[model samples]
Structure formats: structure tokens, C-alpha cells
Target chain A: MCGIVGLLVKTPALKARLGELMVPMLIGMTERGPDSAGLAVFTEPLATDERKISLYSGLTEEGADFNWLGLGHELKAHLGIEARMAVQGNHAVLTIGIAPEPVKRWIKEHHPRLHILSTGRAIDLYKDIGTPTEVAERYDFKHLTGTHLVGHTRMATESAVTPDRAHPFTAGEDFCLVHNGSLSNPYGVRRMLEPRGIKFETDNDTEAACRFLEWRLREGDDLETALQKGFAELDGFYTFLMGTTDKLALIRDPFACKPAVVAENDEYVAIASEFRSLAHLPDIKNAKVFEPAPEEMYVWTA
Target chain B: MDSLKFDLAEIPLRTVNTFLHQEAPGQGVRKVLITNPDGAHNIAVGLDFPVEIEIVGHAGYYAGGMNKQASITVTGSAGTGVAENMMSGRVHVKGFASNGAGASAHGGLLVIEGDAGLRCGISLKGGDIVVGGSVGSFSAFMAQAGRMVICGDAGDALGDSLYEAVLYVKGSIKSLGADARIEPMAEADLATVKALLAAAGPAFDQYAPQDFKRVASARSLYHWNADANQEY
Candidate 1:
């Protein structure tokens, strides 16, 4: 088993406090997984094209439009500067770099199924295997500044011990995901996505789900609709943590074999594999902490 | 002498782990009440002070490893390697202990209230160990010193290659090792066994001083004779 943690805050200052705040929680969970650790922080009101993009839903595999023409190079030419882009949950995150309002407006106009979850600065990323302390020291996470953060500690069962196999995984410019537990039906999902020219680096089932969600969101499906529809297709135990720049989402499998704890307050929202990790944080007392109900999708706003 | 109560579901395991610094400074005798009926692992590890630990349910592996001066009492069946590598202090299992109980023990007393799995007193050096129930195979495979008294039947190969340790089994023996042989339970031996039993706690009341048999090594493995009938 591995440990996963995500926190969403309303203020940018909380983003700056994230690294230091998450370090102790991560340290407390070292025994669950002694392998690699990774974190991704997101800022809202991103400057890239939020409308002309489709989130990469990992549900539908084949016949999805991944046509690069007039998508990548054309957008750069239309816009003055380079756009910050990431792929997550079948949606392409296009930060216009300079102006986020126009890009957010453009995304809302073109893709009705997709909406801007967050409007500030959004960061989507993935990292490799190690203890939480090792990762924090190596990455200097104690000094990083952001508004939203997602982290994962991996225990390799299906995938090989490589950096590529670690989470949080990125699909395009806008989407990222982290997962706990094994998926029994990854091969079936892989068969659907491989034909669409989407290649997977690791044998882990979480990546397969990521690819499927990416494909669906690109086709104009809302995050909740796509996730609700995709939930039935997935088999076995899984508790997923996903996010865009503006919002954080959590999903638990039907069986609830895996564990996910949530602690929420007016200032911040935190999700972790164990209550001890969340309780270890400073100034986190008197918060309402509880385990998430099984097979439910919970989304939080920054 | 402060007492702490740990309830089952409300208990956080990390809280217990963070506080277990028996070798650290300023730690003293404490009374812990385990209100949880469920089993947990690493209940008391690396303890050096004389604290009283009372567990109400079954315990998992290495119940008391590297123990010093504390006394641990378990009221249920113990998992594997109970009291393993015990340096000092005492560990009393009110019920059975799984395999390799008291393996490589250095000092202190290990009293088992019920049966013991294989290799009960393997590699025992010092300390007094008394088992109220039957012992599995290879009870004292390489005992160097100390004393082991089993009030119940002992399994096969009781003392394979023992040194100077004294073993007393009150019940039937399947086999004896290289130099191990049965000896008459003398008055001094009975007195020692009775004292050990009395100290073993409430579960050891039915033990009788007369119904026991004593087994000890004849000091043969220490010196090997080249021309003797022994096979090297």
C-alpha cells in the first residue's frame, strides 16, 4: 500500500505554506510506502486557452480526436507568449501565459462539457519513488510556493520500479492524477485506448484510467458526468485523487478496499490515506476529519 | 504511576509509537490499559524501564523484543516470536506463545501461561523461563545457560545440542538430543520449579511439584572425544 495526500487552499499564502505543512504528514506515513514521493501544485486564473482544450479522460480509448493540427502550434501563434499546458482527466490545461480571462472565456465557449474548475495558476506534474523525507529534501519542497498541492508515495506491485511509474501522472497540459490500490480490468481499458495512438509507459492500472478519462473529457464531457459514467467501467479497488488548477477531486471505488481520509476547514481542505498524516499538521486542530464514503466523488474549490 | 487507557477504534497507533522511548531519558514505570479487544503489533518494543503493561486481547509479532526492565503481561494468544531477544525484565504470556518464543534471550524471566510453539527456549543464555503448557519441537535447541521448566508434555528433540541449561518437563517426552537425559526430580529441583510456577501468575495453579520430569544435558557437546563412540 502507498500513501497519497492533497490539499486545496483559498489563498496563495496557503500555497506557500503547503510544502512545509505537508512534510510532516508525509514523514508520518513513511512506513506505508518507503518508495518514491512526488508533489504537484496548481495556481488558478491560468493565462492559457481554457476553452479550445479538451480534458484527457482515461475512460474512452479509441476514436478520440488527438489531431495536433491548429491545436498546439496554431494556439501559440494566435497568442503572444508560450502557454503553460498539462493533460489531466481527459482535459488539456492551456494557460495562456499572459492573459487567463480570455482563455477561460474561450474554453467556456467551445467546450460546453468542460468548465473552468479554477481560474488562478495551475501546476500539473509527476515525480519518482523515495521516502517522503527524501523527496522533500531532494526537491526542496519546504520552500516551494503554490495554492494547491497533490502528493503520492508509491508501493510498486504491478509496475516496475522506475520514475515514470510514479505518480502524480500527467496526461496533457491541464490534467493530473494520483491513485491508490490495484485495478483488475486495466487490460480491457488499455485495449480501448491503445488503438487511439495513446501509449502507456508503465503497466500500472492507474495510468490506464488516466488515459481513458483524458479521451472522454476531450470530447466535451463534464468532469462529473464523465467520472460517473466511467466509474462502472473500472474494476477492483481504487481511491483516486485528481485535480485541475482551480479544483481538487476525489473518487473511491465501490468496494472501498482502499482508504482515504478527508479533513476540511474554512481555510484549507486536506485528503490523505490515513488520519494520522492529516492530524500531524500544525494548526490543523479542531477540524472535522472523517473517512470518505465508498464509491463517491468529492470535489473541493480553492 | 500514571495510567493511560487506549480504546480500540479511537486509538491511533502512531500516538503509541511516538511515545515509546524506553531507552530515552526521563521515562519511568507506567501502567497501560488496553481496552481494545482486537490484536495489534509491536505493543511494547525496546522498553528499558520497569513499567506494567496489561493487554486484554491477542498480540501480534515481536510483542516484546529488546526488552530491558519492564514487565509485560498478555491475556490472550501471542503471535510469533514473543519476548524475542529479551535482554532483561520480564514477559508473562497469560496464554500461548507462537513459534520461536524466547529465542536468543539473554536475561530476565519469560513465563508462559499456556502452550508454546516450536523452539520455545532456543539459544537461551541466562534468565528463568517457565512454561505452564506443552512445548513444541526443538524446545531448547542450543541452550547455553539459564533454566527452562515445562509443566506439560514436550515435543520431539527436546534439547538437541544444549549446554549447561537445566530443563524440567513434567509430561511425556518424544525424544532427547545428543547429550540430554532424564534425571530424578530432587527436592531442590522441586523447590525451584514450585517457586517459578507460583511467580508465573494466575493460570499456573494446577501445576504439581510431584508430576514433573527433569531433563538436562550431560555436558557432552562441550568436549568431543576422538576415540569415543560419538559420531562427529
Candidate 2:
């Protein structure tokens, strides 16, 4: 079992409070998944020519102090460009005024152990092996601001309770996904994507789904069309909450064995695995709360 | 009736559920009022006595599952499996409900004032479910017995693999399942529909028994044939 929560603000006035609003929603799901937690915040976009890359160094060697600041300076020297790095526990968000491909290649060649979480103009991802509150505090989550956010608290069912195995798996540029239930055919799906040259970082089923979605989008299928095709290809009991650069989408399997609830109003669109995660939202009593129909994809765009 | 109150926000869900489990059927307390439920799951489960429970706010999954001889009311919407596997008594939802509203229930009455999600009354053994609004697809899949009444439209593939259960739909049916077909209502069916509608409350008083279409199993596929086995 896992807990998934997402929020998309319609009113720009509430943008600054996005992290504050999401913290409680994430913590409320601590019971669902106490082993690990993660969140992805889509903040204001960078300059059109700039890019941001979020990376994680999962569990450094014991007694070895990983020098994140020194790595930033080395990256600057290696790429011959200025890079600003913000370290949050083992995760780091590096903003560079350069293209992404060359930076990614540099990291791949120099720091082969670092795991790239996501790369985009607006997205900054953070995750760790701890309680939701602990992870949030490690990242100073409540102070972060964004226009929208998606998070997950994961219990180890198929994979180890490592930071990289935590949820909010990202594959496509600025795209991430969190799943609530297990997948029955992830190995088959991985076999399919592997032949197409899609690299996988984790054996987690949600990562397979993320990579599949990235491949679908690469094939020119829109979010709704990709999800509709997912229903036909992916076989399992699942509730998926996915986000793109500008949109948030939700879909449940045909059986809908997993639970999900959506609450929307003029100010925001909020989704959680249960109503308790949403009860504390602003004006929740007045919001239109409903369970999404099975196999039907619902999306909200910024 | 002697009434007891629980504010879920102040008390843990385990505490309230434990209190209900220990309370005797004919004991001093005859009614329970749970305020600020806020959609906590598995509330008031496994009750075996005739008591009235009124949840003042939204409730989560399996609100009254495996109940017996009790009357439960949710003033707001209910989550999935609201009255699953109930043996007796009545469960009423003032607002909408999620999937499997009365799943695998044996004997009871479940009334939903608003729309119900997918697979409402799935695998129903003997319970009677009445929905005031529309129900999603596969409303009564593999139902063995009892009756289901829907005042609004039904989504795609209603009553798939249905058995002896009787379904009465007042609105349009998107499609019927395999071995399921519409049949004419008998006099006894008309009486049953009217009684169920009346039990649903005054809002359903305007629906005449004649406006509904009855659906039942064909009974021809009870035994498997080699030719039909290809379809499986």
C-alpha cells in the first residue's frame, strides 16, 4: 500500500502556500507508508534558456562524507559554466544557465553513482528513506513554493526501502508518476521498453509505468491518449497520479480496487488516497468532492 | 433510545470501533452519533445487534460492513464497500458513494440518496440495494440473489454474469451483460419495486413501479457447453 497526494492551484495568490498545504496532506498518509516518502514540486519556471536538474545520492558509504559543495564546484569547472546547487539531505537541485544534455553527460561520466531524478525548467524533486515528516524537514519542505505538487509515501512491497526505490518516479522531461497499487505485468512492460532504449533506474513497478509514459509521450500521444492506451496495455489494480510540465492527471484501473478521492474548487484541485488527506484543505466543505470513475482519466492544467 | 456520541476528531478511530464491538445488542445504548467522521475507513464494523448509528459527516471504506440487525445512516457521502457483506438491517447514505457500495452482502437494505460508483452491489448474495441516483458500470456483476433498484441511468455493462438477482432500472441502461436480458415486470415485482421505493424515502415517491425495467439472468448458461466454452 502507498499514499499519493497532489495539488494544483488555480489561483496564483495561493502559490506561495503550496508547500504549506502539501506538508499536512503528505504527513496524513504516514500510516499508509512509514518506510519512505518523497515529493516533487513544480515551481515557477526558469529562464527559457536555463535548466534545472534534481539528483539524489542514495546512502553514501558509511563514515564517508560526500562533499556535495565540492561536486558543484567540480561540475562548474568540468562544464565551463556557472552552476548553483541547493543541497537537501542527500538530494540536490542544481540550476545551470546551460543546456541539459551536456550537463547530464558530464554527470554520467564523472559522478556515475548519482541518480538523476528529474530535469526541467520548473520541477525540483526530493525523496528519502524516512517518515514523511522526517523527509519533509530534511528538505525544508514547508518553505518551498510551487504552483503545483505531487507526492508519495511508500511501503516496501516489491522493492527495498531505499531512497531510490521511493515513489514519485520521473522519466520524461518534467514528468513524474506515483502509484498506489502493485502492477502485475511490469516485467513484461520493462522488456518492451528496454528494447526501445529506455533506461530504467529502479525495479519498482511505478518506475516502469513512468518510463512507459515517457515513451508514449515521446511517440506523440497526449496525456489522455497515453493513459487510455495504458488501460489497454497495463494489467493490474492501480490508481495512478501523474504530472507533466503544466498538467496533472489521475486514472484508476477498470476495477478500481484502490481508493482515490478528488476535491476541487475555484482555488485548487486536490487529490488523495482518502478523504482524510483532503479534509484539511481550504474550504473543503464547500469543494466538490467525488470519487473518480474507473478507467476514466481526469486532468487539470495550469 | 439511549444515545451515545463520539467526536472522531478528538477520539481515535480504533477507540470508537472498539467501543462499538464490545457494546451488547440489547444493552443500555441503542443509538450512536459519530460526528466529524471526515472519511475514516472501516467504521462501525461487525455489529450484530439492532442499533441505530448516525454518522454526521463523510465516512470512508466499509462503514457498516458485516453488520447485522442494525440501522446506520451517513449524513454525507460514504466511501467504498459501505455495507459490504451485511447480514441484516439497513444502511442509508444521504449523499453519494464509491465503488462496491454493497459488495458481497447477504441480507440487508442499502439506500443511497446520491449516485453510486462502479460495481455497486457486486456479488450480492441476498441484500436489497436502492440508489436514488445513477450507478456506474457493472452494477450487479455475479449477483447470486436479492434485488437492486436504480432510479437513474446505469453505466456500461450492467449486471455482467448475473445470476438470480433481480435488477430494476428506471433510467436508460448503457448495455446489458452476457446472459442478462430485460424482462417484463410481474405483479409481485411491481409490489416489490413500490415497497423498495417507499423505503428509500419521500424523494422516490414520484417513481412509479411501472417506469422501471426488470433485468434477470437467462439461466441457459448455468451448465457449460464446449461450444460456449470457446467464449470463456
> Fnat of the models, one by one?
0.00, 0.58
B103-195 per-residue lDDT for model 2 (tens digits): 998999999999999999999999999999999888899999999999999988899899999999999999998888999999999999999
Per-candidate TM-score, first chain only?
0.75, 0.96
Across all models, the iRMS values in order are: 13.4, 1.1
| TM-score of candidate 1 chain A against the true chain A | 0.75
> Which ten-residue region of model 2 chain B has the weakest summed lDDT?
B223-232
The whole-model C-alpha lDDT of candidate 2 against the native structure comes to 0.89
Best by DockQ: 2
Interface RMSD, prediction 1:
13.4
Per-residue CA lDDT of candidate 2, range A208-290, in tens?
88889889988999888899889988888789998888889999988787889999999999999988889888888889988
Model 1 root-mean-square deviation: 15.2
